[model samples]
Target: MDVQSETVPRDARHRVERTRARARYDRDTVHAILDAGMLAHVAFSVGGQPFVIPMLYARDGKTIVLHGSIASRLMDELADGVPACIGVTHLDGLVLARSHFDHSVNYRSVVVFGRARAVLDADEKASALSRFVDALIPGRAAESRAADRTELAATQVLRLAIEDASAKIRSGGVKDNPADLALPYWAGVVPMRTRYAMPQPEADLADAALPASVRRLLAADEAAA
Candidate 1:
């Protein structure tokens, strides 16, 4: 929501661009896709070698913040304003078509290009780190103790000022050759979703408070699926 509509890059694509509706221009749609994803792939180059590392992240309005140990190689370099390409994707289903060529996956993805900066302030870094934890475990942060000085020193946080970004989404059922419609083989989408099971209380725990935030996440996470 922090990104202004005008600040986004041109929505036009090259000749090789995929389906037109596959492209998303609205900011809210892009943010929603990003929010649904729990992880992001950070792509960058060093000494001309391109690399992409998948890591956990949290979005605070406009900026995408990544937290890692100070000793982490990529995070350290990224804090130095390294040019980076970041991608986040969510796979929604598997489309099964009669022909192998028609098989595809339904997904939503976003690619962002920006300059990275290290979070220097103790307060800002701490807050960003908290958001990262909450994104994954909702009430986990509230249930735990705050980071101490030593912990803060050992942590490295980086923020990417997303200047140019684009989101592409693919959904619905399979696309097949018009002539192949007569084929008898089934053709449809196998929907994929994240679900949850009943809470399994920890063995060592007794009477306890299961925070509402955690309860919601427990219901949303379909790890068994």
Candidate 2:
């Protein structure tokens, strides 16, 4: 929860410094944003070619864990201690402008830079996977199917010790030019959100007791203001 600005990731997109804004500079805010979402884009340069792939991730204190097929080159390289960039963003709104040149979107995004390596400990891997499930649906993993030995052996799990991290957020009304304001054009912020409705159990499944964690998450997201 301590604010440590020194740990903020170095700006990757340095060209648009104006669009970048920093809030509290610490893991408190950073980890909270990460735990709230399920998707992350992990980017890395391999042989002078940069590739980005969106994957599901989970955070456990300072370690961020990712899982994928063992055949993935990106995962393989990362496990070899390759440098990587991890990004997570939450879209909040849209900026509607009179002219096409002034359109934009309001969002909260974070970019992290660090070296990643494979997690070998079985205990650590299980804990990471538990958090991954909890982040998505609270306690579904405990109540549902458990990964068997064969399944765990075939999966590749990677970990990144969070080092340099930075976050930027944009909110409120659209930032239109002062001249454009007087041009009698309609300009404003269109709020955006991720919403979920009541859960419809699987077609094959019967009326069964749902996990408390799943119910809690649905309540939370539904209650989000």
Error of 2 at 143 (Å): 1.7
Number of the top TM-score candidate = 1
- Local distance difference test, per candidate? 0.79, 0.75
Clashing pairs in 1: none
Worst 10 residues of 2 by lDDT: 1-10
lDDT of 2 at 195: 84
Cα displacement (angstroms), candidate 1, residue 130, comes to 0.9
TM-score of each: 0.87, 0.86
Q: What is the lDDT of residue 44 in candidate 2?
A: 88
- Measured by TM-score, how close is model 2 to the native structure? 0.86
